[model samples]
Target: MGYVKTTFLMAAMTALFMGLGYLMGGAGGAVIALVMAGAMNLFTWWNSDKMVLKMHNAQALAAGDRFGLVDMVAQLARNAQLPMPAVYIIDTPQPNAFATGRNPQNAAVAVTTGLMRSLTREELAGVVAHELAHIKNHDTAIMTVTATFAGAISMLANFALFFGGSRERLGLIGTLAMMILAPMAAALVQMAISRTREYAADKAGAQICGHPMWLASALQKIQHGAAQIDNDAAERHPATAHMFIINPLHAHSRDKLFSTHPATANRIAALQALAGTMQPNAPRMRQTDMGPSTTSVPKVRKGGKRGPWV
Candidate 1:
């Protein structure tokens, strides 16, 4: 189902690119746009993972250096029957994580520093497991490909604006209308695809962790933290915001129409409902309006400071 949606969205994005080209340079402009879009798609397929990681300035962590983090991820991968993937850390205050690569064999998982400090070991496992689920289910490949196409669509719109479009049949009015509407339409289609993939990842991640509550808790923490802190990298490169587990952008006041992720409240409710089905008597914390419940997990402290490994 994800693959199908990505395919449809990519097709729409590609068509949008072609439309922008036609408005800019008639048949000749479209020919150039197609060639450029095709070339970009090929390049992105091979290097998109690296591109995404680099965009966030993520650094690879050696197994020895990240023993605890690696071990947790390894255990979860074992549970999911997936091959071990490289682990990385992004030096950012935002509590977020993301998985990338074309396939599990070449995949990498990245977590922010704030996530390490904020979540418990069990909650971290739940989060890592969710990212692994994305790799295992091949969501990484789908999203990377979708992003490449969607990016090209927007690029084409920009190209149209810069090159003054084709001097074809469309007079002043049509040209003006196309320039104003094309990119917005492309963004809408791309956001729709992003929303669907996120929901699918949430469900798959919950299954991988075998504990929907853990991920629900992690999501609550990440969302609240993300809302407060700014991920400068994400805001500067909005194109990559969808790659993060949560929308890393700090533009929180925007309505759903302009936002990338689903409402945190809705996501938590869905997870709670999933938990209910598994164990009718499962322990649940009493959740407040938008925060985690009153129940708290004990913090592990080291050197008089709470640490992530705890």
Candidate 2:
């Protein structure tokens, strides 16, 4: 159902893009705009991971780094039956993570310094598993295409506004309508697709990690931490906000219409419901299973001082 909805939304975005093109230059313009959109999507599909990582100032994690995060990610990838994705760390205080790539084999997972400092070992595993789920399910590819079409639509609208639209086709009233509503329509379609993929990723991630509660707990902490600490990179590049596990932008009301991620509370509730069906002991992580001499899980406190994990 989620995939079907995403497919429909993506098609709507494409149609909206072509409509704006037609409004700008009739049928010829629509065809040109579609070709442009296709070319742009192809470029993004091949290079988006590198572009996103560079945008965030992500640095590669070398094997010699003693933090054990790379090792943990390796284990999770094996569990998901995916090729090991390149690992990176962003030097930010915001507790967030995202995955990018055209497919599982070429994927990269980047987490913030704040994320490593904030989440417990199990919670971190859950987060990594969630990202792996995105790679496995090819949500990255879906989102990249959506963004490409949305961007192209907005570009067409901007061009129409500046260069006097196709008066022969749309007239004054139609041109005015396209100028105001086209970008908004694109945004709506993009947001709908993002929210749906987030839900699917959460469900699949819970299964990959073998523990819904772990991700639920991490989401709670991440939501709280993200609200308290601003993610400068995410703020600067708002279009990339949907890529993160949590919405890294400033807090918004629970209105699903304007938000990139589903409400954290709503997502947590869904994960809690999933947790109810699993065996009670199934989600517990053995400390020894983590590499040697790893720190114990941090006890997160609400509205209190930062813990030792940070």
- Highest TM-score, which number? 2
Model 1: per-residue Cα lDDT over 1-310, one tens digit each: 8768877887887788877777778788789888987788778877877998999999888765643677667667877789999899988878899999989998999998878878876677778877988898787877776677677766665555456544345656665666667767877777777777777777767776677988999988888889898898888898888778888886463337767677777777887888777655432222221123223534655566444332
Q: Over all chains combined, what TM-score does candidate 2 have?
A: 0.91
User: Where does model 1 exceed 4 Å of error?
Assistant: 1-3, 27-31, 161-165, 253-255, 279-306
- Work out the TM-score per prediction: 0.85, 0.91
Counting clashing residue pairs in each candidate, in order, gives 3, 0
lDDT of 1: 0.75
Q: After superposition, how far is residue 85 of candidate 1 from its true place, in Å?
A: 1.2
User: Residues 1-310, candidate 2, lDDT per residue (tens digit)?
Assistant: 9989988898899889888877777788889988999899999999999999999999999765666888888777877789999999998989999999999888999999898878777888889889989999999988888888877887787678554556556777766677778888998898888899988899888887788978998898899989899999899988898899989996573846878888889988999998888766443444654554324545667885454434
Note the Cα lDDT for every prediction shown: 0.75, 0.84
